[model samples]
Target: QPTLRKLVGGSSAPQLPDDSVRQLLVEADATNELFKYCEGQGYSLFVAAQPCSYTTQVVAGMIYTVSMSTEPDPGTYYEIKIFKPLPHLEQKARVTEIRMAQR
Candidate 1:
């Protein structure tokens, strides 16, 4: 998956429309807020994935998994994961395909 920074910067990357760019920016802001919240809660943040444009209506943001303790005991380790979807982007699938025939 290409990061938003690379997608918007590289010449070879598909040029996104202005509205899509704006939407991506909004998602980025939301991601930042989530990071701050995790920090305040005393958990170390790890970004599992950077935000990426999934489809015309959707821009998926980072996946975060946070953990606080480093104890070797399994019971002492706990992790909280979070990924917030863009509300406006959530939609029903519009297309379905059967198996493609091989030549």
Candidate 2:
């Protein structure tokens, strides 16, 4: 199951969005970044990347490993890794890797 963390200072405060929420956002961002790092390189995804699933690695920062599929093309998926540095770092998030996923 996805974990939900505390969002506000008090116990009664609402919970933060879980991994599923993060994955949806990541899918959108990854599609845009794909054009940046993948288009000319041969990854010509003709449609929006629909989120399939994703995993997260937490270190000094967070690495999001996302699997997405392009519409009208079943069985074709791409793996995108995005890094989000700690809040203290003040660094902008970036897409570290974008590649086709083997079946």
Candidate 3:
């Protein structure tokens, strides 16, 4: 998977679209919050075992970058992150939301 940097082009493309960039950041923030919440609840967020590679998928014309982390010991938590750009609202706009499954 290519990092956003490469996809959006380098610093040379200074004029990167504002909306999409904003949405991508939003998704990152949401993912952070979700991880924090799980940790606070004393649950280990288990992504997946390596050589683990996160599968990035696009749905509804929006790009989704996903990865997993796992801590095996007592409690286990599953995290699914979805990043969707609201291109319809404004071209190059994205927002990320996350759903968690725990056992």
Cα lDDT for residue 52, candidate 3: 16
Comparing 1 and 3 on TM-score, the stronger one: 3
| CA displacement after TM-score superposition, residue 66 of candidate 1 (Å) | 18
Q: Please provide, for model 2 over 1-103, each residue's C-alpha lDDT reduced to its tens digit, 9 standing for 90 to 100.
A: 9997744332233234367536545544667876676677766657776667666666677776677677566666777777778889987667888887656
The lDDT, on a scale of 0 to 1, for candidate 1 is 0.36
Candidate 2 vs candidate 3, lDDT winner? 2
19-76 in candidate 1: lDDT tens per residue? Answer: 5443443544534544555567675556432332222222363333323233333343
Every candidate's CA RMSD: 15.3, 8.2, 10.8
Candidate 1 accuracy as TM-score: 0.24
User: Quick one: best lDDT, which candidate?
Assistant: 2
lDDT of 3 by residue, 1-103 (tens): 8565544421222232345443554545644665676687786655632111233444555444333335553344334445555566554433344444444
Deviation of model 2 at 78, angstroms: 0.6
Alpha-carbon deviation at 101 in model 3, angstroms = 6.6
TM agreement with the true structure for every prediction = 0.24, 0.65, 0.36
Native RMSD of candidate 1 (Å): 15.3
